[model samples]
Target: MSSPDPAARPGHAPPLRVLILEDSRFDAELLTETLDRTYAAIETTIVQDEQAFVQALAHDRFDVILSDFELPGFSGGQALELARKAVPSVPFIFVSGVIGEDNAVELLKRGATDYVSKGRLARLPLVLERALKEAADRRTLGIAEHRLRDAHAAADRIESRRMALIELSDHIRDMDDPAAMAYMAAQMLGRQLGVDRAGYGVVDTVAETIVIERDWNAPGVHSLAGVMRFRDYGSYIEDLKHGVTVAFADAREDPRTHATAAALEAIRARAVVNMPMTEQGGLVGLLYLNHGEVRPWPSDELEFVRDVGDRLRSAIARREAQIALTAFAASLERQVEARAAELEAAKEQLRQSQKLEAVGQLTGGLAHDFNNLLAAISGSLELMRRRGPLARPGDLERYIGVAQGATQRAAALTHRLLAFSRRQTLEPRHLDLNELIHGMEDLIRRTVGPEITLDVHAAPGLWSAHVDAGQFENSLLNLCINARDAMPGGGRLVIETANLSLDAQAARAADLSPGAYVSICVRDSGVGMSEEVAQRAFDPFFTTKPLGMGTGLGLSMIYGFAKQSGGRVGIRSKVGEGTTVTIELPRSEMPAEAQATQPQGLEPAPRAPAGETVLVVDDEAALRMLIVEVMQELGYATLEAGNGAEALRWLHSGRQIDLLITDVGLPGGMNGRQVADAARTGRPQLKVLFITGYAESVVLGQGSFDRDMHVMTKPFEMHALARRVKDLIDGP
Candidate 1:
């Protein structure tokens, strides 16, 4: 096909530079000769591998590209993408025997100019003719559009400064109200700049929020007023906070605003200038000019905006100061009226007797309800006090047991209160839901009792979660018990665990993060809660259970635990239908650990290696003394420190310390985790145990610990602490 169109199409077309990407030598010659038939003069460059093709694209210029759709070590679409990114004005045509119509259509959609199969080499010339002409046409149109934009920008810049200076000279100084001043400034700027929307928003720097109060809008443009976070628009808010004027020609083209391009376009702010107004070196106001269409923003236009924004801010500040003085005078008038109102209030004192009758009625009902708890405690103690003198050992034991049960109930009430308030400590660790449910199933069935049938569904590939295991079990037990009460006559109860994933939209709807999660759903077939009851189910002290039966803090405490663990819980129910309670915990990204099983009971604390010394740090002296004594009893040499400073002192003393056990909360500005990290820098093999009452969420949330470091929540049994320390040091 090569070398013969010289006389056939003589002097009809200009010199066309074509880049061909094909592996077969014969096919490349055939394609080049075919293109030669269409044009009078042509120059062609051929390359096969990606490296040669990329180098050619970088160093050479070409008018058109011809590529094989299916090539060795390359792809037609990949070539098209590279061509579009590098020299987008060039026409990219695919000419290959293996090209399918569907594949050709997809390549066309992705910016390939056209495709021709080798079986139809005669048609390749015509395809090249159309592609080259279209590319030339696009170039012509782009030049015209760019020239128009420049002309418009020039006109806008010339008129911007003179008109803005005229408007800002005096008009704003006459306004008395801040709102009026804000509207006047907006209108003057909007008309002079010919923008879609111009507005003045009061800034609350401490809150990082702005309230527009009002704005001047062009015809058909919607108003944007009310409170909004500065970050909702773009990261340019950071620049504004630093007293910088931010102007961008296009939201999608500017790096500072591109990430929020869709949001800006939605609000008709494709081009914008946000000017900051400062008072005493702190930002307190903003003047914004926005446009629905993308356009160039000149430096002179931005400077004009800054000048007007300052004048508007000064006028508003003066009005606000005058208003504050007026308000002070008005407050004196209010105080005089308050004194007269007090005299009138004295007349109402005689009506107190009448009001007391109604108050007594309400108090009586509350007292009657409170007596239920008081009776249980008082009756148990009264029996103990009266029978103490002549009681046998067995009788005394029974009476004391009764009194202890009453007080235990009271303690449970307080514990639930702390849990709901998120004041109770939690120790979260990586755990698998399937394994956790397998161990807790039997207990769940027993709690629901014989009448109810329990069903457990564990998804085969349930994800691992980070949560407090004991709190999770307690929450599950509470739900199961609540389900049992709902189904007094017995029904089906289902417990399920499954992996969950949420995208941006779904996560926003669920009020959760967009990522992998583990969900536990407890469903029951019984008389269900009404919408009214379900709404208040998580409210503390609001329960459907009769007095003295349920504390109502159960669900609230579960809610608190879910939130504190960076998870969320939701309940769904309808009258006469079943209820489903769902808890979604974020999947742990920490490296997988062996599935943790329920402890079968405590083993003897493993003794440390010979001559191993333990460094104990705590702010509480009594607790520190107790721990040191325990370590000594466990047959380990112990060194003690009352705070983190003293602990670090011992750590840096070149003394031999086999293990470090410190409280998470410590004085002298060094927490237990920080001390461990610092010590490990010098002694990498130092084993650590963090004892804490508060969650120390920020410290542990890092999820950086190795097998040598462990944590134990406060109020843990001394045996548990001893075992943890021994495990870290001895590595069992």
Candidate 2:
């Protein structure tokens, strides 16, 4: 304030603002004109009374104050006191004729800057110049003192916090118990930081959970001491996981906490600071400060908090390491050598046993399921054979039917296992699940049992998915049956369909790519599963049902099917809250085709036409011979090949082959696909039928080869293969 006013510069200088308290307008104008001689420009305000003078001083800033000693009701002495209170830093001068030198010196001692007598009006310029400069000096000195006080206060605060942290470090360094150290650190932080509560929480990054045992709290404040799923609070937990210090001034105002602001207020955490502690490349713990009032967290406060947190971590570790060392030293001579030897041997045996156990569990479960199916097939076949010539009328056919039924079930089991491995052959169709669910509603109700309630919530304008229809239906039925079993006393089962557009955040959470997807969610209101059960639900051979009641492969098969179809599956279950299994598949761009209805009657397969030559290729000698024999019985001339090379040789021989039948997986130099590609070079219009167990065979029917190509999985009935061959060769 002591420096010259910025507005009073050399060029284009502002007017010297002066307030005049005089009854005579003429004297005021003469006074202003007198000061204008010393200053380039002077602006004057003339007040005739005490009220006007006080209002002018309050409403404006002036460089100088000029008052007449005599006023109608107010004296210059009285005006001086008011001016000293209103603008103490501005110069006050009296330009009065009646004021004597003795009186003037007395007034000057009373804080008046200068006096200019009416008798000597020309000396006014010199008097006014000195008054303004002296006022500027006093103003400058006042500001410097104010700044010095602030700097000293800040330094004191910093030193206080630093000493507090050092003392806390010393206290925690000697404490052997981690809990005691943590609690003491929390208390010191809460008091030093002026917060309502301070605490440290143990983190479990693997489970994405946090647990608090104890914390320091102010009077009447409750502690958040227990296991917690931070996800229930808000999105800021992710920041904590990344070792970021999350600070929010107000829970209600921050976007991250807005959804649960009321819940935050309940814990007196209207504002918060979460300092994450990370170790071994993962979040290990959290040091938190909470308050009921919202306040700005400055950079210095945050840095100070981080320093304290680091010191706390080091001191806690040192104490714990000391304790460990003491315990190790006390027992060193007694058991160290023998214990070490025993531990090594036990570890090696444990590792070997673990490997054997895992292998045995998987193989044993698979063999058990397969043996059951094989027994049914082998039993039915031997019974029919033993009946031989003594067969009752219509008995052989019935026996054959039993064997066929068992064989079909065996094939289904193989497909389910393949699905669980994500290797099942798929015939993906563009399907609107709304229509599919509607069609299956009756069957699903019956399968779940008459006691269970079924509701299908098919969203309008649902996107279609490109997936294997048969696999999708099987997965759905498996889910429904599981739901039914969960609720022994029947409950509501909801099948919900919806379209979702996931962004990167949500997609990462769901372990999927960011894009549009169609989701089918099956939710059951029944006796729900625990966290442990829900986690292993997708593991093959891990089921919870009683013996002979369920094959744990159902969920795993559904999981594999979803993944193989460029999708994801997730499950959520809480005790007494029921379970929900959700499958999210990528939305298909193509239009959905209407499902074809099955006919009530059967039609026999057509025989091969004249000049229809069919080539049969397979790696299995028995399977190839069977197919060749079936072709022979159908009156089709066939060339049998044991491998891809042998089949290509026949095709390249310029023979008139009407259709080529090749197994997708073959030994020797090439597979069926390669063999077809080689032969198609000369015969581009060659009709081919691919028999595969791999869904990669989708390339033929659903993708690139949209014409003159077909596919069927292995282990098909001879009659079905016969019809397919005839249709490809003789029909369109």
Best by lDDT: 2
Top TM-score model = 2
Candidate 1 accuracy as TM-score? 0.45
lDDT by candidate, in order shown? 0.81, 0.84
How many clashes show up per model?
0, 5
**Candidate 1 residue-wise lDDT, 1-732, digit = tens:** 233455665657646788889999988988877776666677788998889899999998888888888777678888889889999899898888888778888888998888888888998878888887898889889998899788666755655655666666576777677887788878887887789999999888778899988999999999999998878888887888888888888999999889999999888999998899999998888999999899777766676777777778877877887687579557646765777655554455447645766456434533554465456766665566556557677877876676656556555554565576676566677887788778888888888888999999999967788887888888888888889999999999999988899999999999998999899999999899899999978876668898778767789888888887788889999888989999999998875456555467877766766857999999888899999988998888999997778988999999999999989888777888888888898889888888876556555754456657777766566777787777677775
Error of 2 at 407 (Å): 1.9
Query: Could you tell me which residue pairs clash in candidate 2?
Result: 1-139, 1-140, 2-136, 2-139, 2-140
Which stretches of model 2 miss by more than 4 angstroms?
1-356, 600-602, 609-611, 696-707, 730-732
C-alpha lDDT of candidate 2 relative to the true structure: 0.84
